[model samples]
Target: MAQNDTFNALLLQEGDPRPIAEVSTLNPADLPAGEVLVAVEHSGLNYKDAMILNGLGRLVREYPHVPGIDLAGTVTESSDARYRPGDHVLLTGWHVGERYWGGFAEYARVHGDWLTPMPDTLDARGAMIVGTAGFTAMLAIEALEHGEITPGTGEILVTGASGGVGNLAIALLAALGYRVVAATGRPENARHLEALGARSIVPRGELAERPDRPLLSERWAGVIDSVGGDTLAHALAETQARGVVAACGLAGGAGLTTTVIPFLLRGIRLQGIDSVQYPATDRERVWQRIGDLLPTEVLERCLAKEVGLSQLPQRAEALLAGQIRGRVLVTPTDH
Candidate 1:
């Protein structure tokens, strides 16, 4: 807000391959070109964000990149007809963090097409806490529901239950009266999962390998999977007849090996959940449902910790080691 006085941010330089998330300043004139410029209030940490920070995956694709994939704030300037100054908005996906400067900085310039109104039900901080991970959770749940998943069907399994998407999915499904069994690699996270309404919690090693049989005991009616390796294959194998497992992340491994027995014979469905570049109508619907289904206190409790942008290095490592639980919020511009 002052001349030559820059705002602090965590910058990821490509050549360095190491994150230097110190107190850095940014000038408004240097902001990337976009239809709307927002003063970001809050940002959320995700597994992908960790990847960007750690340079483990080829996500950022650029040097000195700001690696937040989700943000919520109010518009400070708008050149597009869809938004104006003083409007509250939020954004996720659509290559904003990867290809363009993201919300890790105090100000974010994003394309008008990538922005959505911040629903009255949520403010800037709440929006960041829900962020991209929670949105994907709702999307996975929606996919399962569209495929006829219901409370009456049977128990629903949520893999990587300690992560942001998994945590929110467990809470949402449980709130809707579905029996939710959360799967986590960290046995220490069991209590947190239970507090989030997970009916049961199990160790991740149980689903680490390919199933001995093409089909095992039918357990879940639906699943929200954030891990994509043999765990997904195992969940598919263990799913009940005609059950669905929405596979999203590749935390364990990306490769899935399984036979058609679960599909052709048992009528199992492995639904893929993609959050990036979804149709606007579908995105709006998911947000509306998230507003209706996710309670405030639950969302509040879901946040495990809050950190400044400078703390991202340690945060990223913790997430990779599965040493953290619940959601982590990055207050890019606030104290």
Candidate 2:
């Protein structure tokens, strides 16, 4: 496509009480200043994308914005030595969706430093399937491993188990020989979670409520918690001695009303994971590891649906309501 040719994009415009999301057309010249131009093949729907889609969280300070947090595609132009035309690339973090134009468009222009050369093991579609959610999951697991947690230590608990990060975490941990226990509010998805490599399922009620006591019976050797609030408090209370908990998201709320007894008595370690703005130097290595570790079948199974740019508004509502089960891919050009 020529630089002046129009392409479809999901545009968020300022509105009465919230932002209005719509499908609009734009030329490459309309994109913000950047070093690399990419033809976005696929972008992933994430929690933050949902917030931006509906104008929640005050994530976007400007109108007429694109709101996809991560994407995979091939470069069409570059002004930087680190990238060249036709090179496959993927991007996540660096606040592209929030503070800048992102992959909700058929094309995106971004800083060369914000892009990772796509691994050969993954094509555009496959890379987006393992998008930001999987990227964060890998980071969480790396933290667990760095804390000396191993498969033989005991069961690894994944909270928000039916969501994107939790689902991928179970699959990755199981593939690495760790027994994974999935925790979710929807009991109906137990079979699905188990199929994704969860050895067992725990009801969300088991951990969602605030801990009545400062400590509980030791269970998980490690935890990949996407849900904060009471779920985190409960998880911390029950973590085994020297256990590690990788805190990634706040789908369950951001408050922490627990005591430090878990950290003091059992030596539990709570590590916060920041996928956004995570060093670009380490991204390519992590993406390669995700490609090497997560099986193709598992990755494919984790995909919940694919929607065009026009469908994002309603899908965003579903996602924020906790109705989305796994990863959702966005086809920017389809609309």
The candidate that wins on TM-score is 2
As a whole number from 0 to 100, the lDDT of residue 96 in candidate 1 is 76
Clashes of each: 0, 0
Q: What TM-score would every model get versus the actual structure?
A: 0.95, 0.98
Candidate 1 residue lDDT tens string, 1-335: 34465676667765665555555777876677889988888998888888877777677666777778898888988899999989999899997788888888788888999998888777888878888888988888888898898999999989989888888888888778888999888888888889889989878889877798898888889988888878998999889888888988988888988888889998888888778888876676677677777778889878989988878778989998877787899888654
lDDT of each model, Cα atoms only? 0.84, 0.92
Q: For model 2, how many clashes?
A: 0
- Candidate 2 similarity to native, TM-score: 0.98
User: How does model 1 score by TM-score?
Assistant: 0.95
